[model samples]
Target chain A: MKIRHRDSDSGKIQLEMTPMIDIVFQLLVFFIMTFKVVAVEGDFNIKMPRMSAGGAPSDQLIPPLRVRLTTPQDPNAPVCGIYFGQRQLASFEDLRNEVAATVGGGGPNADADEYEVELDCDFDLPYRFVIDAITAVSGYRDPSSGQIVPLVRKIKFAPPRQASGG
Target chain B: MRYKKADNELLEADLTPMIDMTFQLIAFFMLIINFTEAEQDQRIQLPKSELARPPEQPFEVALTIQLMKDSKTDQELIIYGGEVMPLANLQRVLAREREYLTRTKRSPADATIIIRADGRAKTGVVQQIIETCQEVGFEQFALRAQQEEAG
Candidate 1:
């Protein structure tokens, strides 16, 4: 007995394009409405000050470098005074130089566990200034690759001080 | 000499080009859409920083906190999940998050917190939020900032 391999009524199998087109249009509308074009975002990783858990004594050799940020007497002053240890910095450039020097110009000493930069800012100081201070001390821009090669990996905040009389 | 009537029924619109254009639009939108916006608050203007760089790897999971301040009063408004909550309530939410992590057998140290604060927001307020997170045992933090425009 010969078996019929094909359908008795042979015709072009039509695909309903209307439903598929409708769904695709729906998806296009959804995406268009929800789309947002934003610049790439980045982060400055910070470790929140935590109480010591009494681990083994650190083998750090270098002492922590301190930075102090003080607001001006005038409430509306745009710039704040930045200090590296006991010496006052003339500008953010000066702060960077001081940090580079303290961290040994991002040399081998910069890799030491004890090499830390602690930021001490008055409570009234704007956060933008503090961020500038962080950026200044965080690293030096490598001229060759134009990348920020981190100088001091360890950073912490000194307990914020109350704003004094302005 | 009689003329034959011509068929006008074959003039249907060609939907193939329309479908192609729609698909192209869909592809463009799909490529540009940022799903992360769900976790970000448009109200917060991130501070720009020269040292800030994009994370090497995206965190598998993170809790986003948005901090805003009243321009006139300087009072902080903490936003979580699109709702404004007091700082005390935020701590409670953190506690609940910690509990959820514990139940999931994940350590708080493994959890990450992202703080998106307005550029003008006070540093002290941001620090307080960080300290609060620290108090709850979260060790990793990502302070979001916009990349400084190069001159």
Candidate 2:
């Protein structure tokens, strides 16, 4: 079958690569802009605490106060306690008292509609203690103002460790 | 006159289509840009963990603990994020913050505390930071970590 028809006259079968090239350039630009240079920070040695359900605190909008749990270097004593700013929480009663007093001190301005408690606990601390402390702080009421308020509403847990295995 | 002109002999590709594609790519990049300039050190490679999840909402308020290496040694400690003060001071800070929130009638839990530390940091150092937050009655905390993005 020898049938040739003058090579179809003009022979113009171009793929209009201009549009494709434009798209490729566009994609390149998109990737360059969207490319997030993520810089990983923190100790690469320590294994973070595995959270089951509530996992790591994911909400940044919720304000949390930092608390550190420490036992004095004395190995013989079980004097593990809480440190808020720089003071130790000697007893649960003290926490209770503080919460109650603070609420009371709010005075005429005290209102339940505007109060909350933030809890930040250490990873190694017994879970029960944290709960107990939470309860005490949460169930506080101002005696003088007669205003009941939950000390904490949103909780953000701190990282388990700062450095590697201590 | 016979070879005078061939109609449509300009042979130029229409540029509108190409411009449209370029615009699309630019839009995509703009969407993924993270504008928050967090001055974090790059040398510190964060430990990779499955636990790393970006926060749901930007933390509007936070109690920050800036951990610094002992200029003299490798030791790390809570430096600029509230240390060497009476627990009362913490209570005061919380109370003050609470009091302010109360006046505005905002939920007291509307804030977060970010505990930032060096990667070569120690557990004990971090734990101490947590204790401080607890004493002032903070119940929540967030430990930061990172992982390599897989191809």
Question: Which pairs clash in model 1?
Answer: none
- Best candidate, DockQ-wise? 1
Q: Which is the leading candidate under TM-score?
A: 1
Q: Write the per-residue lDDT of candidate 1 for residues B7-112, one digit (tens) a residue.
A: 8655757799999999999998988778776567777777788778888998866888888876777777899878888787788899899999999999777877
RMSD of 1: 4.4
* Each model's lDDT: 0.76, 0.49
DockQ of 2: 0.10
Every candidate's TM-score, chain A alone:
0.74, 0.42
lDDT of 1 by residue, A23-102 (tens): 99899889988887686678777655365212222344565688998876764565679888899877887888887876
- Could you tell me which 10 consecutive residues in candidate 2 chain B have the lowest summed lDDT? B43-52
TM-scores, each model vs. reference: 0.82, 0.37
